[model samples]
Target: MVLPTRQNVEKVLEHFNRKDGVIVVKGKELRERDDTDVEVDFRQESSFYYLTGVAEPGFYVVIDVATKRIQLFAPPVNPDDVVWMGYPDSLETLQTKYDVDEALYTTDLDARLKEASAVYTIPHFNLTFKDEAIKSASTEDNDALYAAISEARIVKADWEIEVMRKANKISSDAHVKVMEAAKTGINEAELYAIFLNESNRNGAFFQSYMPIFGAGMNAATLHYNKNNATIENATDMILVDAGCEYNYYASDITRTFPVGGKFTEEAATIYSIVLDMQKACFAELKAGAKWEDIHTVALEVAAEGLIKTGIIVGEKQELLDKDVVAAFFPHGIGHMIGIDVHDVPKYCTSVERIDRPSYRYLRMRRTLAAGNVVTVEPGIYFCEFMIDPVVKAEETKKYINVDILNKYKSVGGVRIEDNLVVTEDGYVNLTTAPKEIAEIEALMAEASSKKRKLE
Candidate 1:
C-alpha cells in the first residue's frame, strides 16, 4: 500500500492546483542497494508514494491546475508481466483504492502534458522526465515542482509522526533482539542478523538505512556498517545503531552494550557518562530550544564526566573552552528523521550560522519546534586519530591524562540515542526499547537458559 488515501492526494493536488502550473508526479523504481545489482525493487517513490497509495514502479500522476482533474499513467498489466515478475495488482484496484480521478497507460502522459497549462515535476533525479516534458511543451510554466513538496515535508504532520513512532518502535525492538542474541564465539554479522529478523517480524517494510553492527574499536568508527568481526565476550563491546523505515518514515537509534551479558567497570563508566549526557540534552528539548544549545551542554557534561574518570584533568570549563571535548565527541548530537534518515529537505541550506565550533557539520540546526521530530544521541568515542593528536599536541599536553587513558585503549566507545518529537510543552520520546543493563542481561540469560534446556 504505497499510495496515500484520496484525501491525502487531494491535499497535494489542491496545493499544486492553487498555483499557476500543474503538478506532474513521476513514480520511479527502487534499484537494489548493492552497487553490483541494478535490479528494481518495485517500490514507489517516497514523495509520490506519500501522495498516492500506488507502490508499483514505472507510474506517473498528473494534476491539471487549469482544468482541476487528476490522471494516473501506468502500464496495463499483460501476460508477459505475469510470466516474468508475476501478476501485478490490477491498476483498476489501485485507482479505486487511492480514489484518484482516472487511470491510463504510459502512452498517454505526453498527450496529457500537451493539453495542460504547465507541467511541474520533481527536481534533481527527475532529469529524464523534466527534459521530456520541456521538449513536449514550449510553455513557460513547465518548471520545477520540488520546492513546494520539499517545503510541505519540512514540518511533519501528526500522522507522519505516528508512522515514525511505529518505525522507531520496531527498530528499538530489533536492538533488544541483538542484545539478547550476542554472545562469545558468534560473528558480529550473526548477532546483527537477530536485529534483521526481528525488524522483519515487526512489519518493518524497509530498512531506513544500512544497519551499523560493529564491535569493540569498530564502534569508534562513526559509520561502521561492516558486521564481519567476531564478538568476543571477554573484553569487546558491541554497538548496534540501526533503524527500519515504514511507509517511508525512518527511525534512527543507537545502543551500546557489553558482549558478555554484563558491562565491565571500564565500559560501564564510559557508558554511564554518555547516558547522562544524553539525559541532560533531553532536559533542554522543549519547543524553541536551539540544538546547538543542547549540544553545548552535552559536551560540557562529557568534559565533566571525563574529568571525574581521570580521562582528562583540569577545570571542566577550561577544557571545554579549549575545545578538548570535541576530540572525543566529534559528530553532532543528532539529525532530523523522517522519510529520509537525514530528512532536511534542503540538505544544503544557507541557514543562520550557529555559534557552535563546527557549525557546518551540524546536520539539524533549526530550533526545536512543535510537530518537528529529531534525535538526541550523545556519544563518547575513543578514536585513535582524535585522541592521538591531542595526546602528542604541545598545547593540550598539560590537560592529557595519558597514563589513565592508555589503560583502556580498547574500551572502544559509548553511544545512547533515542528519537524525540517536540511538543507544545516539552517533548515525547518515540523510542520504546529496553536500555538498562539489568533488562539486557535478563533477556540474554533467559535465551541462554532456554537453549540449554533445548539441548
Candidate 2:
C-alpha cells in the first residue's frame, strides 16, 4: 500500500472521530486539468493525498462515522485498458491494497455517499460534484466535516516525515551533482538540465517548482528561472535553487558554486559569511524556537559581516536597525516543507493566514515543532541594481561602500540551503550535498578535466 498503511490513515481517522457523528467524505478528482495541446504535469491535490494516499486520479474516499469504516470510489477498469495504459487494479485488489472496507466503481459513489447523513468537502468550486454536494448538504453538520478534515492536515505524521526524508535525500544529491558539473563557460541551462536529469534518475518525477538557474548578478532576482545566461570564464558563480518530489513529498534546496572550479577571493569571502549565518540558524532550531528569532539572527550576522568587509560603511547596528541588510540578503530564511514545498500551514494562524517573518516574508511563518520539516537558506549577493538605490540613498549614504561591493557584484553571490526536520531538542539536516567551497571546486575541477580529456 503506497498510502500510509501503518498508522497515517489511522491517525487521521482518530482526529476525525473527535467530533461525534461526524463523517468525512473526500471527493475525488473533481479538478483534474484536462490534457491539452500544451504539456502539463497532473499532480494530485495534496490534501486528498495526505488522507487517502491514493495516487490515482478521479477517486474519492468516504470515512463513515457510524460504522467506523473507510471506502474508496473509483472507476472500473475495462479489459481493453490493459492494451493501452497497462492494467489497473481490480475492485478486489484496490480494497486490499488500500486496506479499506470496500472499493466500488464510480457509478456507485452517490449511493454510497447517500448513506451518510452529512458530506464533508472543500467549498463549492468548479469541479465534478461541487454543485451536487452543495445541493445535497441540508444541514450545518456537513460544513463542519469539511472544516475538520481540512484542518487536520496541518500537523504531519511520522510516515509523512519518512516520505519527506527520502525525497530530501534524493533532491539534495541532485544539487551535489550540479555543483560538480558546473563550469565557467557552460550555459546556465546546461547545469539546470544536469540537476533535472539526476533528480529524475533518483525517483523524483515531479519538480516542486521551476528550477532557478541564475548566474552572477542574475541570482539577485528572488525568482530567476531563466537559465540562459552564459557563465563568465572567471570569478563568477552559479546559483541553483531547485527541489524534487517523491510521491507528493518535496525537498527544496539551493546551492551556489564558483564556475571556474575555484572560489575567487571575493567569492570565498561572501560565501563564508552566508555559510556562517546558515550555521547559526541551524543551531537555533528546536521544538519551540520561533522561526522569526532565527531569521533575525541570520540577518544580523550577515549585516555584521557585510559591514566588516567594507561592503557597507555604516555601524552594524545602524544598518540592522534600518533594515538595510535586505539589499544584499532578502527573502525568507526558510519555509515549511512536506507534500507541497510550502505545506498547508493555515491552521497555525489565528485566522488561517500565512504569517511571514521579518526580512523573510516570501515563505510562511511558524514556530519550530517536532514534526515540522523546513528549509534554512541564507544568502548574500551584490546585485548592483538592487543595491544601487541603497548606495544612492541620502539618508544612509555613508553606509554605502559602493566601490567594495562593486568588486563582488559580478562575482555573483553565495547561498547555502538545506532541508531540515525539527527534532525534540534541535533538528536534523536532511540535505546530503557538500556545502564547502573547496569541496565544490574539487568536484567541478575533476568533472571538467574528465570532459576535456574525453573531448
Candidate 3:
C-alpha cells in the first residue's frame, strides 16, 4: 500500500519553514555478514521511510524545499548481478508504486544535486555516493531538516495509528501464547521460541527489539535477554517484555505472571502493585497532559503499594521525597512508542528534564498531545542491586523493614506495559493481553485444561 507520505513531506516542509534548500536522505543498503556474502536483514531507516514510503535498499529521497516536490532515486540495475538477484522494479513502476513526484536512477542523482540551490539532510546521515554539492551543503540546515522530520513524526496520521494498533494486537496474541505454554521446568528458550513462532506465523517476521524472557530472580534485572534458564520453581514469576513489528510499526508490551498457572500470595501482591502503577499512569494520560506528571503518578502508586506491603514503612510523601520509591521502581514509567521502540524527539532542547532521582532516566519530558502513541510501563523489582543503595544510605535507612524485604525477594520483579494512543479526552489502549489477576489466572487455567485433554 502507498502510505500517505507525500502529505508527510508537506508536514515536514511546514515545520522546516525554509524554501532555500533541498532535503536529502539515503535509505539503508544491503550489507554482508563479516567476510561472508550472506545478507544481514535490512530495515529502512525510520527517518527515510517517513519521507518516502520506500522500504527497498539503495535508494535516496530528495525534496525541493520551495516547490515541495519529492524525487526518489534508485540503484541502477546490473544485468550480470540480476541473474542471481533478479531484476528490480522499473523506474516507471517505482514512480507509480510509491508516493513520489518522480523516480530516477542513481546515475542522474549527482547532476540533480549539482543543479539544486543547496541540499539539506539529517546531520551526519551518510549518502550512498560522494558529491561536491552535498558536502558543501552540510551545515545547520541539516540539523534543521532533522528537527523538521522528527516534529512531523511525533503525531501519527490515522493510517499510522491503525498500523500500530494492528502491531499491538499481533504481539498481544503472541504474549498469550507464551503465558499459556509456561509451566514449571519449562526452559526460557522454549518460551522465547514460542513467541517468535506465533508472531511469524501471523506474518510479523521482525521483532521490535530483542525479546526478554526473564524468569525468577532473573526478572529483577531489567533488559535481561539471557533466556536460557529453566523455570525450576513453581512459585516463581516470569516477565516477558517483547513485541513484533507489523509493517515497520512497533508494539512494546510487557506482562509478568506466575511460572505455573496460578500466582502465589506474595507474587500476587507484587503483581497487583505494578498493575496499579500502570492504571494510575493511564488515568493521567491525555492531550496537554504533562509527561513528568504521569511518571510521578506511577511513582506515587508504587510508594503507596510498597508501604501497604510493609516492605517500607514511612509517610507516602516522605518516601517519595527521599527517593525511596525509586529504588524499587528504578526505570522511567515509559516513553513514546512508534517507528522505533523508543521513538525520537521525545526530548527537545527546549524542554529541560527534571534532575531528581525519579526523573533522571525518563525518556520523555514533553507535554502529551492528541494523535501521540506511547507506552505506559510501570515496574517494581525486588532487585538487591537497586535496594542496596537505599538501605546503605543514612537518611533513608529508617524506612526499610529488612525482614519484610527478604520475605518478598523470592517474588523477583513484576511489570505491566501497554501501548496507548493519546486522545483529546483520554487514551485508547491497544493491548489485548489479559492483565487482571483473575483474567490471567483463568486464561492460563484454560490452557492447562486443554493440554490435559490433548494428553
139-164 per-residue lDDT for model 3 (tens digits): 67777778888888988998999999
In the range 1-455, model 1's lDDT, one tens digit per residue, is 43344455554544442454557777885467677655745556777766666667878887766555677788766687579779765668656767578888878777777655555666544434444444332222233245446545656777788889899888888887787677788898897788888888888757878888889999999899888998765568888888988777899999988777777888888888898898899888888898888888899899989999998989988898877887888888888777778875534344665554434456756667787788888898889898888788899878878888876567787788999998878889999877776776687778778767988
lDDT of each: 0.76, 0.73, 0.89
Distance from true location, Cα of 335 in model 2, Å: 0.5
Cα-based TM-score, every candidate: 0.87, 0.87, 0.98
Off by over 4 Å in 2: 13-39, 65-68, 78-83, 124-155, 351-362, 452-455
The per-prediction tally of clashing pairs is 6, 2, 0
* lDDT string, candidate 2, 273-378, tens digits: 9999999998899898987789888998998888878888777887887678888886778778787787665334343332422353645556667877878999
In candidate 3, which residue pairs clash?
none
Q: List runs of model 1 lying over 4 Å from the truth.
A: 1-18, 30-38, 65-69, 87-91, 128-144, 346-348, 352-359, 448-455
TM-score of 1: 0.87
**Quick one: best lDDT, which candidate?**
3
RMSD (Cα, Å) for all candidates, in order, is 3.5, 3.5, 1.3
lDDT-better candidate, 2 vs 3: 3
Arrange candidates, best lDDT first: 3, 1, 2
